[model samples]
Target: MEERDKQLLKMIRKQSEEGMSLLIDEYGGAIKAICSNVLRNYDAGIVQDAMQETVIRLWQKLSQRFQVKKNLRAYIYQTARNCALDYLRKYQRHSETDFEGVEDMMQDVSTDVEREFSRKHNERIVHEVIKEMEEPDRTIFILRFFYYETVKVIAETVHLKEDNVESRIRRGKKKLKAELLRRGVLNE
Candidate 1:
């Protein structure tokens, strides 16, 4: 760990206000980026909401545990990812989605029962598979493929070099494709 990371841990373990402030100041941008990427389909308001919830959860987790088992940044990244997914699930199940709902997704899709069911099922599997992926790759894959976000936008949002983002996306796509093929979900 870096010197700053050790200090941050000390401050967190001590439960100091300045520590929380510093933590948010340092990681807020990354958390927002993750949430924004994860909730790309949603409006800004939902992204902001997810980001706020992520910070709160992080604060609570640190306050309660006072000990981090792994790298702090990675832990925060995972927290943000899980928090955004939870928000996404909650929004799907409960939020009013007249503007962008299941209907919107299905609007252009075929009406074939077998194809539709298989597609949705495979999509769910893909999501689950993506969730199980490691950091950076998971975020990169979702931002690139699922959201169809531009490489520049993803690089800026995730604070990675544009070429790095592209390479990661390439590898992520290849990995996802292999996994899907292995699972018999991807014919090609």
Candidate 2:
């Protein structure tokens, strides 16, 4: 490692207050960043708590059986990450959704199921229309939409220029929209 890290480790080994202060001064921001990234979805207070816990854990480890040959930055990062995870496990609630407690939940679920069924039915109809399209249009539509292929890739696959591939996709979308409308899948 760097000479500074080596000096820091020596100070930590000696258990000096100046060493601890130097460690915090050098790594406080990085330790906080690690904790904040791990606990990004949590409140700022939670991140702060995890950061404090990391410093405590680091001191404990450094004063005891921490491997001398290990990299100090890596050690601090791992400690911060573990401390954040511990905080997450401690604070995160695992309560299940109480369906019975919420009276409208069941009713809302049934309507959601009906809407999903309608969406699937509409998709099947659109797929049928796409299947009826001729040759390269059918292949292009399948590759572009179904397989999520880029225009350049589809052009290479179909032996067509990029412009041709784009034009085909645009036309295919218009056709799909018209067919969807005719089949009462789309209104207005």
Q: Report, for every candidate in turn, its global Cα lDDT versus the true structure.
A: 0.81, 0.81
- lDDT per residue, candidate 1, 81-130, as tens digits? 89899999988876655555676667756766678799789988899889
Candidate 1 clash figure, as a count = 0
Off-target runs (Cα >4 Å) in candidate 2 are 94-188
Q: Which stretches in model 1 have alpha-carbon errors above 4 Å?
A: 95-188
Task: Give the Cα error of residue 167 in candidate 1, in Å.
Answer: 10
Task: Compose the digit string of candidate 2's lDDT tens values, residues 39-118.
Answer: 87788998999989888888888877578564676677678889998888777653243345466666598898999899
Alpha-carbon RMSD, each predicted model: 7.3, 15.0
Backbone clashes under 3 angstroms, per model: 0, 0
